[model samples]
Target: MATTTDKVLNRKIVEKARKMKSYAYASDDPEISDFSHPSVINIADTVQVGISTGGSSPAMARKIKIKTESFLKKNISSEDIYQIKLQKFARIEAKQVLSTQLDRKKFLYGVMNDKRVKGLLKEGKYKMAQGRVKKMLRKLT
Candidate 1:
């Protein structure tokens, strides 16, 4: 149970361990195992969203992480992840302010459709987009 410098072998070892229901942590060196190590990517997040693809198809999982990193970026460029972040922030802020469930849902869904917000996002003016979104969210608070 020594850590192998070979990445492919490490992945295989991790995969095997995953089948044991001791699934979450993969030890590099069992003798001095440190399962508490932080993974660069959040496996829980991907799993919750079905991104791990687990045994379904790792290649597909890789493609999902590689291809569309930005929200709905399968239709856009990879560099557009920033806009997605802005949108996510806007959504969380809106949710915090809007009280009624229906109103919050509608506002969040329509945020992207608003001409000002959309235009700001399209222009990559994240600051302006955030400001605009905050102003809008304040109205519902």
Candidate 2:
């Protein structure tokens, strides 16, 4: 049962969201709105991982999200993000160069699974792999 205060708060939130040209639904369920918090943007700057409490507990979800974000921020680097973007571009170009899906997958698999590329990546030498991927793509085009 919602108390009088809860009802009032819900009304206020609905009004605010409406005035802001948005829609609002009242939910005490944690998982449904955990990422809607402003601090989520800060967390996303490093990495994004979803935590779900299945609408049972918000406190536990918040704690888990904090720990997960801290771990990701410590482990993930800007270079890793850059490498992901580079691979995305390479895949897009490969789609045009390689006619068949199998050929595209095989070419990308070989590029990514190359011993030199793996070694360079393990050594935190993303730029080396970036160069190699771009060069290979250039040769294909």
Candidate 3:
């Protein structure tokens, strides 16, 4: 007879395995879920294999070191970082325009005057153009 805890754990492991098996390996669908739980048997098998192979591997450690070094070497500049942040916030504000009658012109002028948004425009992210049009609606309402 299985204990309550043992039954719960088995159910969790089976559910996770099912979820993992449901998705394609190279899926482009962003909504897919990925979850997997290793069982005790799986852990024992891996340990036995490792013992037979002899000696632990450093491949993962080396890969992480190389990735860290590469990231430090190609770090984004302050201006680029600012531009990315502005683009994100601008997208949020643009979405809000559909729900509110905020003065579009004033809102846009407000955004243009904002240091972050101005930096985004200078970087040539034309998506902000929508915010400008929304500003016009703000004026009419």
Candidate 4:
């Protein structure tokens, strides 16, 4: 088997790892991060927001990772996935509705920051948030 170091440093592997890390960082799936730290946090599947110093400062990375985990636990809800999904669906839907790149960008921005959606997300009401997003999309289109 390829050693952990070998796997992480290879360019293609790094790219794949980064994508996997992004998902773990964003999920509430309950898993450990791929860090070499002794005290790894099994925080989204939700911790470490993909902060790497490219082999320069592992300690700093861990510090930031732990801090982020704490911050999320304090401020962000693990189930607040509505915004993430909305962005994805909206991007595809916007292509059908929006005629210009600028219009799509503006529409996405408005959807991202809508307070009602944020409130729904924080409360873990993803279905309600999705419903609101569909309404928003309809209104905008």
For all candidates in order, the CA lDDT equals 0.59, 0.63, 0.43, 0.63
The best candidate by TM-score is 2
As for candidate 4, its clashing pairs are 30-45, 31-45, 43-46
lDDT of 3 by residue, 1-141 (tens): 111345455445545656666432111211222422111111212211111111122344345445554454365444444444544555466556544535443454465466645655667754664455445446645
Q: 2 or 4: which has the higher TM-score?
A: 2
Question: How does each model score on TM-score?
Answer: 0.49, 0.57, 0.29, 0.53
State the displacement of the C-alpha of residue 112, model 1, in Å, after optimal TM-score superposition.
0.7
10 residues in a row with least lDDT, candidate 4:
23-32
Locate the minimum summed-lDDT window of 10 residues in model 3. 46-55
RMSD of 1: 8.2
Worst 10 residues of 1 by lDDT: 39-48
> Clashing pairs in model 1?
none
TM-score of 3: 0.29
Candidate 2 total steric clashes: 0
Candidate 3 local accuracy as lDDT? 0.43
RMSD vs true structure, all candidates: 8.2, 5.6, 14.8, 10.1
lDDT of 1 by residue, 1-141 (tens): 325786567666666766674544333333223243321233223222235543344566667765445443344442245456766787688667777778877877666677887777778787887888788777766
Give the distance in Å from residue 85's predicted Cα in candidate 4 to where it truly belongs. Answer: 2.3
Cα lDDT tens digits, model 4, 15-60, are 5657665422211111233433233454454343566554455677
